[model samples]
Target: MRLIHLKLAARNVRRQPHRTIALGGAVAFSALVMTLISGFVNGMDSAIQDNVTLYSGGHVLVSGYTVSWSGRLQSRFADEAVANIVQSAYPEIRTASPISQTRATVVFGSREVQLSLRGVDWGKDELYHSSLILSKGDWKSLAAPRTMLMSAQTAARFGLSTGDAVLVRLSTASGQQNVTDYTVAAIYDDGAAGGMSTAFVAFSDLTADLNMKEHEQQAIAIFLKNSTSAENAAQTITKALSEKGYTVSRGAAPTSGALSASSESFVSSVVGSGAAGTAATGTTTGTAAGSSGAGASRRAAAGTVTYYVSTVQELAGEISSALGSIRWIGYAVFALMLIVSATGISNSYRMVLLERTKEIGMLRCIGYKKKDVFSSFIAEGILLAGGAALVGVILGLPVGFGIGLVPFNPHGDFGTALVQGHLKFVPSIGQLALILVFVTIVAVAAVFLPAKKAADVVPVEALRKTA
Candidate 1:
């Protein structure tokens, strides 16, 4: 608190340049590592979020499921009505894309690849139109019926060019194999953003091929103006849908296509199919006509749908888990680095305490209190750590930016999917400030015992030893 003690602490710190540098180096190194790790994690999270929003789904996803008595999960839904309700009710929603997809094999001459065939509404889907970068052909050509778009990777593997006709083979809702011919309209590059290569076709064309009626889709993805509000938005939407006589799932659906029983019933039937169809699918006559289970089956046959709502966090189940694991590992490394820095501070202050015993005796004889000595020592530790951490953070900004300058192939491997064709380092100012404060606290704590011992020195004993 006094200028005299601060002046003495500063002079003492300067007297041992080598020791100060050694201790400061440990603190600086820890701070540098913390900044880099935080930057890398933030960059990766941003990249994954962008990819998921543009390519896979929006921040919030609404999927419809129909479960049969045999427990087969079917991707059949008439989601246009629900999509309209959500869009009209929530001003935060930016876009709601009604999408339908099926597993299909595309054959061009002798070469063939099995990929997901996604039905996209070209007239209303704005996310893909703005986000996808095409390598060949025109995006507007997708408006034509019987035309499809494949990724550049798929096109290259198939040895096919734009305007070529490919036969797509897929199973219908009734489990019958069906074939359709589609001309390649465009090829977009995904940069291997971590998903199966999916081909896109006109919504009407794909739905017609799959025998789905008007305004029918498997899911509706709700994009938000801000991605951070997704959890709250999902909760609000779930409540609204439930109040409107819709059956909503209590939790996130399994991302792996393994859905549990609906909220009301275990036995259900396919939409547009009567109880006779349920019986044909192996449900007993009693099960289809008797109890609550039978009533649920009849309701399902009468077009009742179960909605599964999830946020992008839940949709990216495994990827989110992996990031969480990486974060914990980062924390472990950060703790170890702090411990090393703390040890350096402790050892350096102990030497200072031994060397300054006579100086402390002189100060005590001049009316300095024990608290003054402790305060001076703590201030020195803080200055050492605070200055070092500030320098470390200042140095990390350029280091991270320079690392991001070196480019890598985004489409070559799984590792590249975590970035956007290059390394990204998004250094946060708040994170740097927190690191500085934490390092200073650790340094002061580490020097506590040494400072206490220095303060306990008796004036007579110290002067006698020196004499």
Candidate 2:
């Protein structure tokens, strides 16, 4: 029965080549628009994730509240023992690296730029390697005191490079300022984050230069085996830290139910439950953190810490949510286009049905069931939709790739500087499947009511109509 319906559908479509082409065109055009939008969204999302992973570790970020100088200053700290406990509790933790950050003024040859200097254990942290794309020198240079790695943008701004001397001034607690001269060990480019002027230095060297106190970590970056184990690992780690009497707070990847719920509620209220909601929710989870306060209070809270644990997905979601308006506008335009295309298909189908009335009546008179007629029409819609989807897939490749080639703000915002390079458009297989399924469903729906109407046509009346 299916084969028969397919045969009839194909034959009917072939009989009126122009109508078939028109229907197929509508479906193909709609699919193209959907594919383009989906590709853009996915591409942007991938870019953001790559950026975050480069800056922060892929797993967990532990930080304190009010330490928000771009994760530089710390009002709270994570004890070495707390990290030890979490490591022992969960074998899933691959590596643990402590980091400290500070804002400092970097000057060389009369040129100066404010830099977010990241202090990291060069030997332990893979994040520094993954996040930075070095143009010159080596990370090992940062191991020496008075040596630093400047971003390409920073290097350019300061008119400095590897082997060049730069002056760094930092503010201290005693209302004093300390100045040190450093050699630029490396120049790196990381789009907005690095390109906007940031620098990296050895944790030990940075501490010595700034006169930082012991047991003070702005944050701890943890890498895990996989994303599946990330949330549980964060929770277990937070719990262990709390049990060890530390004030913990969650950061980018919050595993706790309360924090997740609160974040979801907050996001839902802001973006509603559409793509915006998904994007916002994912972003929040990606960047959850947990923090422990420093001093006597931290000791008193032993075995308990305030921590924030956010998943990578959460960070992506939040960023997507933040950019929901742009996505929404894109989707809105696509939706309008889809409606117009579907309407065109419906009109074309209606015309075909009117012209084929005699044929339909003859089929009915020859004992073809009404259900068969309906099925045939539906099959035609499906065939047309499928052909269109195939064509869309083919056409969309170059178009999507071309769009990706257009350079936009790498910072993802219009206000910032334009990113100089092109982006590659990579489409997700899941997204393609979704587009195909959605288009097929819409085509079927448009054909359904009209199919029923065609099925309801009285055989005698249809046969009596003059061509």
Candidate 3:
């Protein structure tokens, strides 16, 4: 009986070619809009996320607060405690590198610029190589403390390529200034580090230059077996360190401009409910392997605070917020399209039903019941919506495919162009399914009342009026 009704419904719909085209077109357009917008937003989120995770830092970063000497601000961290905590408690760590983090000024002849400087344990700098696009020189030379790496933009700005000497001046931990010359060993095209405004050196070189001990560091970039394990792993590692008689500092959520935050920055982003609310920019390219556990070990010292921990997701809070805002924008566009399509479908279906009143009444007078007529019209709507959604999805897939094919390389302008909202488009199957299901429900529901009204017409009255 259902199959017969469906056949009759399809035949009846075929009698109104113009109405079918108009109504189906409305649904198709709505589906198309939702598909593309959602695709673009999700894609951007992925790109920005990969930009940060694969290059800017690791899945989790451990650090302490920034201190100031005169007007120079610097961020500091101690590595031994963090390494010991991870090695002893969490076997999940794939690779970890200690950093000597600071902000400094670079001079090329008379040219000077402020930069975020990091001295990395080259043996375990997993993220650096993953995000690296070295246009000149080799990474091996950076094994020396006097050797440094710069961005292509910085190299161009200073008119210095690989092997060029650039003067660096830094504010020491003791409220004094220190100056040194670093030979540029390589220049990268990595955009996630904000181009040339961020640079790297050998960890020993930074410690020696700043007159610091080897057991200390500014931060530690830790790659884990799973990025999702960051919060739990952070807590477990914290507990292990505490058991060793180390006191951990607390922190608030990071300001948009800050790096791996201090102890006061921990509550909202690192170890608690704050992470529950975050809109995770999905993971990609997984954590890379590195030489795990190579740094100096710290004694189980009492009365000392180990570093604070923040995930790459927290480090990318601002970008995630920006990506979320774009999603809202996409939602707005999709809502607008839905409204327009619903109004068009409703009004057009009403007009078509008005023309079909006599046909409906005649069918009612025969063996067909009102519910039968209603079901037939509903089946027609289902088929129409299904057909329209298929067309829209077909149209949308190519667009998504084309956008995905475009590579992400935000080098020359430090991804400024991308930051301005030009981002990659990822073809997410889940998003596509969501759009199709939503559009289908709306399209089929829009004509329900109109079909019921047409089916309810009095058979005698409709025939008499037509006669």
Candidate 4:
């Protein structure tokens, strides 16, 4: 009975080619919009993951707070004893790398610029390589003493190349500045890091330059073998560290100086120096300059260390959260399109039922039951929606395939003219299934009232109406 209704519904749809085409076109258009939006959201999410993984490693970062410097600089780890205790408590730990970061000014000849210097174990921090694009030289050379990697923009600004010598000056806790000469061994260009103003030096070199004692590291980047063990590991590690009288903080912890100078520069670019000063001072009142100065000094006095640890899933979550607005907009647009499509289907089906009212009444008068009539109308809706969805799926393929050719700016800002070399589009089969199910459900729901109304029509009244 169902097969017969389906066949009859399909034949009925085919008989009115224009109506079928219009309905099918609507479905195809909606599906195409949905596919594009989903693809874009997925692409954006993937992009954020790539950036974060490239920039901050997977999801978790662990660090300590210092009283003396900005938030980024404050990363104090529990002594080796605490590290051991934490490791023992969390056996799921796969890899860990100690990291230290500082900001300093590098001068080459007449050129001078401030740079954020990150010190890390080159071998352990291999995950960050994808985010680090080297135009000249290599990361291996960073192991050499008095050698540093400069950002491409920094390199350009200083007119320095690989093997070029530069003087680096850093501020210490004692308010004295320490200067050292280093050779630029490599050039890295990643817009995510704000281009070439950033530099990376060896952990040993930074430690030696700062004259630090002990193998103390400010942060530890941990990667677990199984991401599911992350929360457990974090709990165990936090417990172990707490037992050792050390405070464990997550990546999202609030602290002063969390904003980098580059971030400040970006803000300054957007909102003038007054805005920058307000941000730096944390108040619009320029009156309390002295208090602000004192607060800055006090913040500088609190020397803290930061640790970051993230699972792959956590990293993905962070990315999703960051791109939440875009995803919401995409979903909203999809919903509107779906609503429009559903309405179109409902209206089209209602018109068809109205036009065939006499035929429906005549059939009812003969042998067809009202239940059969309702079922037949529902079958027609399902057939129309299914046909449209099928056509939509067919149309979506070429559109998805063509998205790769669409130009994209991998970097969020539109200032640069460089085209993204690679465009990625990955559509999940699960997501597609969900969309199809949603469309079918909406179509079925839309037809229900129309079907019921058609079944309620009196045989005498319907017989008076035209086909």
What overall lDDT goes with each candidate model? 0.75, 0.65, 0.66, 0.63
- Which ten residues in a row are the worst by lDDT in model 1? 277-286
Looking at model 2, how many pairs of residues clash? 65
Tens-place lDDT per residue, model 1, 26-54, is 88888888888888777867776767665
Ranking by TM-score: 1, 3, 2, 4
Better of 1 and 3 by TM-score: 1
The residue-by-residue lDDT of candidate 2 on 192-309, one tens digit each, is 4413455778777777665656665556777776655766877887677666544444555232222233543442333233321122112221222334433111111111223455
Question: Judged by lDDT against the true structure, how good is candidate 3?
Answer: 0.66
Largest lDDT belongs to which candidate?
Answer: 1
Give candidate 1's TM-score.
Answer: 0.87
- Ranked by TM-score, the better of candidates 1 and 4 is 1
Model 2 TM-score on a 0 to 1 scale: 0.79
Off by over 4 Å in 4: 66-74, 89-92, 129-133, 173-176, 189-197, 225-233, 243-245, 251-322, 405-407, 414-423
Q: What's the TM-score of each model vs. the native?
A: 0.87, 0.79, 0.80, 0.77
Q: Write the per-residue lDDT of candidate 3 for residues 1-467, one digit (tens) a residue.
A: 39987898788678888878887887787777778777777666555555555544567666643322221223454435457666668788888777665678999999988987778788877767765777788887787669998877777888988878888998765446899889999887645433324788888888777766677566667787776687777777667755654434433223312222242233222323212111111111111122357432212111122346666666667767877887888888888887787788778778878788788878989877888888887787777877787798789878766765665555553263243224555657887787778876876788799878877888999888877
lDDT (0-100) at residue 56 of candidate 1?
55
Which residue pairs clash within candidate 1?
Answer: none
- lDDT value, candidate 2, whole model: 0.65
